[model samples]
Target: MKDAPLTPPLCSTDAVLATLPAGAGDLPGAMIVWEGALYIGTAPGAGEGGHARILRLPWPGGGAVEPVYEGPEGSAVTGFAALDGSSDAGPALYAALAAPGGGLILQAKAGAGAFAPVTEPGLGEAARRWIGPLALWGGRLVAAAGRAAPLVGAIGSAELLIEADDGSGTWAALSEPGFGDPGNVAISLLTVLDGTLLAGTVNPARGFQLWQAGEDGAWEQRIVDGAHRHVASPALTACAAGEGELLLGSGGAAPTAADLPADAQPPELLGLDPATGWELIAGEPRFTPEGFKVPAALEGPGFGWVKTARICAILRDGATITAVLAATPQSARPFGLPEPGAARIWRSEDAGETFVEAAALPHPLVAAAAFDEGLLLAGLAGGKVRLRVAT
Candidate 1:
């Protein structure tokens, strides 16, 4: 019946598959399609303050865009996780460097060489500056240290829950720092549903907190007051579709279109149904704790776009699951399109209930991966530039 509206692919710039350099940023920063190639990862952007690199596109797309690993000019490259190694360590690829003496977690072995560090920066404290969304679940590797750059404004600390497990790169501190709430500084995001392992925090005073990781690993809070909305001031992007479902979104703040509607504040997408928990597949609804929800996503929330609200990427594809849109990218170059605003994409098929807007990209896409046979987009950025990084 309604199967005719699925033709949206050219993604702009001839389906760009490589564009990394010039600060490595456009918002989201961590794509993953290893070995054959496709490993972005960026954080610092906005001129002279951009260097957190890690590029290498070559798979299911075109090719020629290699940097591999570069962090250290101001460092960036927030998070990325991949580990099957299959033994003799034939598959590694783990990154999470926010640089400056309090963050690191490199390690890339089995083909696209060179990425060492293993642990030792923030794991040793140095202040726990920033480490990120890395998740693996029961086997190990579950990072989420503290403090981040949701654009530009970083200064909250203590948000642990960092683990590692035998690969020996050594990392431990399963949470005690902020979980004790130092205003719960940061845990940004981590995923894994169906085997359990969830965490999302960022507490700007009070807002954003979703924790669950048991079986003796201990950590159960699951959607505290923030889910009620402090503007979702913590939780960043997350994804764990299929089987019990899980997909939370929102970013405390810093996603402005010059203060849209008068003070910015619109970027939501929460839905966790372990049985009947938080609902509202998109933004703007009310009452939660499992009562009144009312938003099955009808082009609302950030989908009602204006930029940021923090969600740069959350794709699934197969059963359709996409949500990529972030602000602060005024592309005039660096792979094309995105000049005044335009880089949409939202899809959900029978899983999240409803959603459709598929493609509008010209870049500013942020991060996506599923390569080989198809799919490897990146940060095509958005429109409107001319600030020169003073934010």
Candidate 2:
């Protein structure tokens, strides 16, 4: 793949419309923007010793962040979804929490002031595994569990749960035969596209793959051989309804025996067709900011060299797609814990064909979502959350 030139940088100076109050040590988790409000989930802050909480910040101009519920310590909020018109009580916010015992799912009204724990419909432990990556689709809540196994020769499985408007639901095991022999792959991310459930997985060699589920409970795999050079974890963002398109972001580079070139580009964003089993429509290695260079001397712990960085979060608005890149450059010598360069936000107006730097934040972004037209919300590693709006 050929490298592309860096485009003009977009500033977040006039874009930062507001900053809400978050806990001292809280880490941002899943976020969803719906019906004129921004809902955010948080993990335990550095010092805060309690279960994670869901906070809602009024949209358009609402400036305060308020907690909706608080659970046990180390119980982090992982996933979120807004239930359909099943209840007269308004929209229901479903959150996934990583607790000491497997995992927990909680449901609450959009503006009910608080969340009440509800037994997740159809939850079961086939072999006792950790559940994560939750998605709200077609008025139903779906979650997947990553089977715990050794680093090599590990396999993963997935389950689907459907919760009724009244909170009643059923759980069924998804047969993803395309994922080799079922127990050989691990599912990492789950999303919904065009009334179907989609999942991404990592093979033992770190290669990326995709799978989809139909209404009949049948799951099929979509493979894109040689689409990514190294490990490419899938990052799913929204697309126009009925368009049958999904945006995917990956930071893993093409496998290279030598260090990355000085002009090495960031991960490429691509469009996938869920109905056709995730056909690759378009993709390109994203570009870094102009004048932003990666030092050749930065490396990781033992190898004394940082291999590749990955894309963490993505926000798409119309034809424009923005990506947050976290890169760790390979270092020739260790400088006692490298700062890893500053994180950059890249924007592509024409799908993933080309890109330019949209913003530069001091720290790496852990999570991000499109707040509104020309507005973006970013949660950083240092427990800082900021809102970026058009100037």
Best by lDDT: 1
Question: Model 1: which ten-residue window has the lowest total lDDT?
Answer: 382-391
Tell me each candidate's TM-score.
0.31, 0.71
Across residues 1-391, which tens digit of lDDT does each residue of candidate 2 receive? 2112222346453444455465446656667765677777776543457666777777756577777777666566766767766745457777776665555677776556677656532255434233456777665666765444212235434344444555454454455332454432444467776667777654434455666776776666554332443333322222222234676655432111011223333444456665443323233332222222222112111111132244555666666766655444433225624334334566667654556666555444445544345435453433456654431
lDDT of each: 0.60, 0.50
C-alpha RMSD by candidate, in order:
18.3, 9.0
Candidate 2 stretches greater than 4 Å from native: 1-13, 17-24, 45-50, 86-90, 120-129, 147-160, 163-170, 176-186, 224-244, 252-266, 274-308, 329-333, 336-341, 371-375, 379-391
Give per-residue lDDT, candidate 1, residue 328: 38
**lDDT score of residue 236 within candidate 2:** 28
Instruction: Give me the overall lDDT of model 2.
Output: 0.50
